[model samples]
Target: MAVAPIIVHPPLGTGGRRVTAHGRILGLAYSDGDVIEFLRRAGLPDAEELLDDPSWVTWRGGRAHHYEAA
Candidate 1:
């Protein structure tokens, strides 16, 4: 058995406060794609696969803050 790789996200810029996703602190990257990529690269294959899902809402600044559960 081998350990999986982790891609830690930078820090979220939510009015100076950190955002919590799945109970973990989120980091703000330069773009939303980065955040999405971070989720994928962070050993979350399902996160990467959801990029094309209609529920995925990526803002203009690469921020997916308005994500709604579908």
Candidate 2:
């Protein structure tokens, strides 16, 4: 298995804080590593692939969102 390249996106909010797909606040965004860790904690398979692909992630109301890719 290979590690997918990280795709950096702007933080969900003005303060650059981290939040969940549902808009639940997590904390300040630090690095891609933190996102990966969050995904891992959420038990999402192919977390790296999902994070690397912009199509896999979305944003609404300035909140980061994610869903299963078709």
Candidate 3:
């Protein structure tokens, strides 16, 4: 399967995940909204929708929408 260009890395011990697009660090996202904003700033046409799109976003080490890291 083809991987998504945007990668939302696992949440850190302190909190929030590292967001990257093609290895470019966008910002740290504590919530989905943060991710959208970063994408919007990065010039993504439909930033918010990209979250639900598997072909556009990849959530690693945790379930989507769950920020609590075990």
Best by TM-score: 3
Candidate 1, residues 1-70, lDDT tens digits: the string is: 3222222322335432232344454554444455566676655557756544434322332234432222
List CA RMSD, all candidates: 10.0, 10.1, 1.0
Q: Lowest-lDDT window of 10 residues in candidate 2?
A: 61-70
Give the TM-scores of the predictions, in the order they appear: 0.34, 0.47, 0.91
When summed lDDT is taken over every stretch of 10 residues in candidate 1, the lowest stretch is: 2-11
Q: Pick out the ten consecutive residues of candidate 3 with the lowest summed lDDT.
A: 61-70
Clashing residue pairs, backbone N/CA/C < 3 A, model 3: none
Write the number of the candidate with greater lDDT, choosing between 1 and 3: 3
Tens-digit per-residue lDDT, 1-70, candidate 2: 4323333335443444343644444434455556666766766666666753655443333334332221
Name every residue pair that clashes in candidate 2: none
lDDT of each: 0.42, 0.48, 0.89
Whose lDDT is higher: candidate 1's or candidate 2's?
2
lDDT of 3 by residue, 1-70 (tens): 9989999999888889999999999999989889999999999968988898999989999788766666
State the lDDT at 23 in candidate 2.
Answer: 49
Q: List the residue pairs that clash in candidate 1.
A: 10-27, 11-27, 11-28, 12-27, 12-28, 32-62
